[model samples]
Target: MEASPILIAIDFGTAFSSYCISVNSGHDTSKKTERYETETVILFNENQEFEKFGVEALTAYTKMTSSEASRYYFFQNFKMELYNQKITENLMISTMDSKQLPALKVFSESLRYLKDHALKALSETVAESLVLPQDVTWVLTVPAIWDNAAKDFMRQAAQKAGLIQDILSENLILALEPEAASVWCKQLPTSGFIEEQAGILDKSTVQQQAGVQYVVVDCGGGTVDITVHEVLDDGSLKELQKASGGGWGGFSVDSKFTAFLRQIFGPVLWEIYKNEHPAELQKMMHTFSIQKCTEKEDIYIECPHNLAKLAAKNKDISSYFSQLEGACWTDGNIKISYEKLASFFTESIKNILEKIKEILDTPEISIDFILLVGGYASSSLLREAVKREFGSRYKILCPYESQLAVAKGAVIFGTDSKIIHSRVSALTYGINMSRKYDPLLHDPKKRRVNKAGDYTYCTGLFLNLVSKGQSVEHDEDAQYTFFPVDDDQTEAGFRFFSTEKLNAIYIDEPGLKEIGSFVLPMPDIRLGTNREIHLKIKFGLTEIKANAIDTSSGEVQKIKLKFMSE
Candidate 1:
């Protein structure tokens, strides 16, 4: 007898993936509440597909095997794919199928790999109990930036990955990775608020400073994500505004860094980056990975002797790439300095700071604290950039376990039943004004020359409460008002847009599964449409809200999940 597939929470991130499944006591033995996590990478050989799953695949790749793998390796958190305009048809998972396949298909297979591993973990844990495959439930997390169309693509991928059609309901878990990281950092705090600030509040009986508002400037390998978040009243969160970000991460820096390295160290260096990277060559790789350099700087990185052996069997390259460990390029007996590497990474660090400064200058927004997370967030160059701009406006809090913050926060929130809890504030929503566009005009940028007032077809645009990271108590009323464009039509389309920045879920390093999206209708509304579009966005559980303005119009649009009339 085997235990049923259990309920699990997977924090499938952009750089790394993790699954935290609940483990209870066995049948006939008390159910114990324990949990475990696994890194989300799937490496496999063409013939040894069965041998590849979870951490096992990572180790097996280094071993000698008669069967050729075609070197198929998949890593989730390849979130950088969302913005790349060049990736249209075949993804990195192209070798699997003979023809050019939809990127979505390859992405789904990546997710399938992770889910399959999670199911295996659960199966092994509860082997004594009776379990069924259908018993397992899964919840996945996505970045809070993608729109509905992308998310719709993700839903289809999930279905192909074996989710029953009946259970296939898409819910957007709009977590700002940086904010999520901040929440995780706050939970593991070493020092309280600054001493003088803390004393002033206590001695004067003033309001307690809620906590730190860490601005997470996540400089990832491929993209740079900047997020600002504050702790909520209920030990949760409140995103000050929409997460401001751009395509600036570690990978972006790496490209430029590689170019700079090639300029200085010559082209022979790139051959070492191909195929597998050995321990000794890894030092050189890091040097090449740096973005730029400063005056009077020297590039000397220390590497092991084993790189020569690695280079011999893996990548066929210049003499510098002597196979010492894997496919790593190394000196016969020379040394490399990390000191030079740091100096070379400054250019990338400079760009990241400029982006953050622009975010700070946005209307009605100023980040108080700086949070450092993600792979590149640990870079000393990035930290200095943050320090220069912030200048003690708030202290920078870097968690030792910064990389794992998102996975941990997601898992914690997942296991929390009360976390999804919400309140219903209003019984029904009604537009107070009817077709009133006879209002203010003359912000020429927004309104036409001869219009009653500035009216947008997007009733969804008139949000009254909650921008992004704010955690609300369940059943709270989400209300907003809309002024008609021209008073031309009575009916209005109430489309609901996702409150996220990027709603993409990646499957592996070369493939991306669009499992998350925001559902909104692009309504062709007219002028003078003065009507309050009232709807409710509850605290817990994410859902869709589409609208068809006039049932007679037959025009379907993305609406709030809650009923418009009920």
Candidate 2:
């Protein structure tokens, strides 16, 4: 008999990435059903040849020389690039050595590493006879606030990484990070390990009671995603507020600390240190990362001798450090005070708090609890700051292994996606098409003579399919039918646009952005211009899916919309 279905969830994060695997037994109450294991992939060098991954990668990177390390690509905190702008096919990431690498290539490599590591780990833990690639269902966790283009980009990279044989296969799933965390937390009662670690005897205590609302704040390395959910009597979750967030996350704190170093060392010396002493800088940054997670009055970062020597020669650089406040150099190490360290977190923390407040201030949503999850959510400093800001007004709950919540929750989501019944549309999605000219609605100047000499308004009227802020059921498809405008037309093109306005008149309207286009090849023109094509679009899922069906030829085509600009 085939073994039970194994679900694997890959959390491709900004600074750290990890995977969790779970085997689901047929029985609903079986303890075996909740057993899941996770492994974190580490990035490091291997024998100065190829980069190693997982724990081995971390070790190898540490042992490499400065020059060797510079040549090696260690991608951490790289996922933020996807959210930096309107993601396109040409987006690239710059490595520490100033080499430009395609973002998709980097993401695929990371996925490949995670897949190989997970397989090797499974082979060692479970009998090799029981595990097979086909038996596994892969779930990739993504930030809920990411655009359709970014999500599609991840799907493509996952395909390139060999995680999924086909993107449309049910075996592969994309679980929104915040939704996954909410589901995982709700189902923690079945998990033996997570419940114990979280010190919760009854996992239902974390579940929002009927009529109560809660907000999940996913504070990952690169982005902070906030969403509000309402609990129904049947224990189902309904998204009360649309997902929203910014780049104010843990990496922002790290970036501020780096900026502080640049201030003390001066730009010229800092550039020298970054290029010439990358290994030392890496080590220092790693130390800082560890320290930031723990509570401390002050932290010391060791300065390289070469940096000190250069600093001594430059009077301006030497004076800069001497006059710096809340920091001092002694014994070749710079001591940063707790006050100064906390300043690094203030900006990001404030941004997150403001977003939370904005959500809570929404007219009808009454959030009772704020659930914190993700890697940055595990930071004591961040935790304390959050509690200090809104602890009295709202209950803040940070479960154990908050960093792994998204990945572990993703595994549960792969088993059942109905945990989140509905989600609010973030934007209005529609298509532009020509319509019959009406004197009452159409401007006379917009009317044009068609092939048959009939006056028709070809000025791209937007047909709204999904309106912004509208509640849509999960996996629900909105269908619309269109007919060919010309009798001999061999192809039909649909231009899709998303905007914040409920009624966008045209593609050129302000605040309207074209997300993608769907092209359908028509059948024989003998069917005539009245041939109807059914276009289906779904907006509730993580990515918008479009399909076109030629009713005349009985040909159904799955439209893979291209997000990049030509």
Candidate 3:
């Protein structure tokens, strides 16, 4: 008999990355089964060579020689590049030493490291004979707000890293981070008001059985994704509102802290400290990261003797630090007050609260509870702020081990994907086609004579398949039939576009963006432009898929749409 399938989840994050594995077994009842055996991926290298990953990477970087450290490339928060709308195919990652490396290569290497680590972990946990890549299913968690191009980029990187043979295959699944966390939270035990409410609500009565509605606030290191869902009687979840978020995350707070540091130290001195003492800078940032998650009233960061020495060399830096408020250097350590630290979180926290308020204000959604999960969600400061703002209106619940929710939930998702019954499309999707010219609607400049001498408009009209904010069921496919525009055309091309407006009339309209294109070979087009091709575009899945059928010859073809960078 074949061994039970193993589910491995990779939560590739901005400030950090982690992976988890779970055995597919219905009999496991341990409380920890739903949680991920997480491992952080932090790469460290000396002499510009790839060395180690995870905790080992941190240890190696700490012990490396200063000369060696200066030559090393320590990449952190590189995942933010994918979220950048301005990213291009030629984008390259810049190292601390001003060295440049291909972004794709860095991402692929990180995935490769995670894959190997998961394999090693499975081999140690399970019988050696039963451990094999083919027996394992991989689930990758991505932010829901990411564009199709970013998602496709990650898929391609995973393929290059050997994480999956083919991304489109069932062996590799993509789970949206927010949705995955929601699934995991639904399975976990709740407490306080939410638990009491669940008990009081009748589970059997149809009259009181609309199920509880909740909003998931997934606050990660890079982004915060919020979505509303309503649990059904059958325990499945239906998305009641579209997923939305911004780049206001924990890293943004860190950015503010860095700015504070710049304010104390002159820009020239700060730059020198970063370049000359990369290892110390990394250690300081790591310390700050740990402290930010705690409730400490004051954080005492070790002032690297070298940084102080560098500062001493500049009289302006010394003068600036001497006059800095809420911070003081003593015993070679800088003590920053909680008030100062909390100020760093103010902007990011405000942005998050505004987004949640915006979602709640929607006339269609009525949330009874709020579920907070993700790395940033674990911050006590953030939790208290959210509660103080919206606690009265909704029961706020943050589960144990919330930071690992997305990865662990990804494992659960790999085991059973039907937990989420539906999703709301974030954008309106459609195809571009030419329609008959109308004097009242079409611009005269767009009018042209067809091959059959018929007057037609060549306007880039949008043929909508899915509308923004529309709820779409899983595995839903939208089908359309179109004929070739020209006789003897060797191939037919289809352009897919997405827009925020539901009634977008043209592809070039504002807020309309071209996502990708599909092309179908029409070798049998001797039948002329009258031959029709039936195209089916699948939505409500992790990624969109298209299938085209040549109606004339009954030949079916799968078109792989390539999402281009805007």
Q: How well does each candidate superpose onto the true structure, as a TM-score? A: 0.58, 0.90, 0.90
> Model-by-model lDDT, in order?
0.44, 0.76, 0.76
Q: Model 1 clash tally? A: 75
| Candidate 1, residue 228: how far the Cα is off, in Å | 2.2
User: 1-566, model 3: which lDDT tens digit per residue?
Assistant: 12236777888877667676776544132432333333343454544456776667777776666677787777777787788575555568866556667777778888888888778767766545546666777888999989888888888888888877765656778899998888777766434122234543334321134577888999998999888889887877888877889898898998988788877886888888888877777778888888877585899888776778887776533465577888887677788899889989999999999999988898876787788888898788898899999987887788776777788777777777777888888888999888778888876776776666744656688899999888888768898988876777777788988887986887888888787787778888678888998999878877788889988777787766677563
Best by lDDT: 3
Please give the lDDT score at residue 382 for candidate 1: 65
Report the Cα lDDT for residue 296, model 3: 58
Cα lDDT of model 2 by residue, 1-566, tens digit:
23237767888888677787666633132333232322233353433233665446655665667777776766566788888477777787775556566777777877887777676677677545656566688888999998878888998888888877877656678899999888766655434222233333334555545776889999988899988888777777889878999898888999999999888877988898787766566667778887876586888888766677778786743366667898987677788999999899989998998998898888887877688898898788787777888877876777787887788777767776766788999889888888888888876776766677644655678889989999998779899888887788788888888898987776777898887786788867887777999988777766677789988887788877766653
Question: Cα deviation in Å at residue 230, candidate 3?
Answer: 1.2
Off by over 4 Å in 1: 1-7, 23-77, 84-101, 126-137, 163-174, 191-212, 260-330, 333-336, 360-368, 388-391, 415-566
Full candidate order by TM-score, most accurate first: 3, 2, 1
Displacement of residue 529 (Cα, Å) in model 2 is 3.8
RMSD of each: 11.1, 3.8, 3.5
